[model samples]
Target: MRPLDLLLAVGVMLIWGYNFVIAKYGLAELPPLLFMALRFGLVALLLVPFVRMPRGRWRDVLILAVMLGLTHFSLMFVGLAHVDAAVAAIVIQVQVPASAFLAMVLFGDRIGWRRALGMAVAIGGVAILAGEPRHSSALWAIGLIVTAAIVWAGANIQMKRMTDLDPSTINGWMSLLAAPMLLCASLLIEDGQWQAVTRASGWAWMAVAFQAVIVVIFSYAIWYRLLRTYSVNQTMPYTLLVPVFGVLSGVLFLDEPASWSLLLGGIATLIGVGIIILRRPKAVEAQAQVT
Candidate 1:
């Protein structure tokens, strides 16, 4: 890859990694489902005008909107509210190995010994992280995130079967569909959303805008380009930096405590995910979702 494109790839990682902290701050001023509703609604408003609608692939598109966009973010933010951004960032990496596990089970994809071992190591690392005594009280929240990761991995598997789906417009359509569903969910399950939206700080609103515009739209646009222009080996490896920046951002920006178990377990998890991502065939393109 060229120097400029490499920098772009790294920029995407930074945007996505920093978003963990961003979402945590955003959640302070907005309810999770309410915030997600606004974020996806704005994304749809911005993107739907530019991209073509998914006419024939509505089945796959709706599945993504409901499962990944609505359900995943709902669980993630709820879990994030009880945990540190660094933990959320690191824990979600479980999806990498889980995706591999699902691929092997559902599609009969070959899981070489190295990958199976990597998956085991990754799961073990997450167990260590989850068992950290400093945050053991939040096990229910952690469990929610783990469940979300598995569901997200399932969405990833479903995406693999959608050979005809266009990456460029699918996010737009998903957002368009999910925004209303999220709004309905928030109304049903949450309280004080009206107060939350009305009394939100400027920075809080900016955080929402940052997530919708920069993280989802801008970074994804660049990442899709990088994936199309370069081999998966060239573009995908830079994503390893997400947890590093995630940890750093939480520590530096949010003053979040980083326990020993967090550091060690996160390292182990990333190493295993590294194995899974790096071992992929050169030609196989990874799904563009980062969160």
Candidate 2:
């Protein structure tokens, strides 16, 4: 990658790293689904006009919205409400291997024994972190986060099928669809929606704005630009920084505890994720084989 693009990749990861903390702060004031509903609504209202429609790809985009915008964010924010952001970041790393494993099962993509071991090690780390919880509710919360990870992996799979569509187009239409879906979910299960909207502070709303603009629009724009230019292997390594920054931001900003189990489990998880992420793609492997 060029120096400027590398910097852009790093910037995206940084915002994502801090996003956990930012979202936690926001969720404290607003219901998780409602918070996401507002974020997507703003993104849709702002970007829908500037971007083209999916036209032929509505099914894929809508599935992505359900997987990522609805199920993943709903479970993630709800999980965030109960667990520490730092650990949540680490545990979510399970998605790295989950994606690989899903690819193997769904598309006959190769993971081999190396990546298989990587998956086990990653899950074991989550198990360790899962044990760190003092209460059963926290375990359930962790499960929710893991389930979110699986859903997110499914969303990635959906994205692979929509490669011809611009990221902006996919996200724009997704936002317009997802906002109402999230609002309905929030209305059905959550109370105090009016109270949250009225009572949320400026900082809380700022957090939502950051997510909508920085994380969604700017960062993902750069991310897709990078992916278009370079191979996945080149950019995947940068994501390792997310949990590092997540831990630091959570520790320094939120004063969340950094117990020994957290340290051990987080390290183990990152190691496993690195093993999976740093691997070359099968297509690249085939190219090399031909050479």
Q: How well does candidate 1 match the true structure in TM-score terms?
A: 0.95
Q: Rate the local accuracy (lDDT) of all candidates.
A: 0.86, 0.85
lDDT, model 2, position 29: 96
Off by over 4 Å in 2: 133-136, 284-291
How do the predictions measure up, each by TM-score? 0.95, 0.95
Evaluate residue 176 in candidate 2 and report its C-alpha lDDT on the 0 to 100 scale.
95
> Positional deviation of 146 in candidate 2, in angstroms?
0.2
Question: Clashing residue pairs in candidate 1, if any?
Answer: none
- Cα lDDT for residue 25, candidate 1: 86
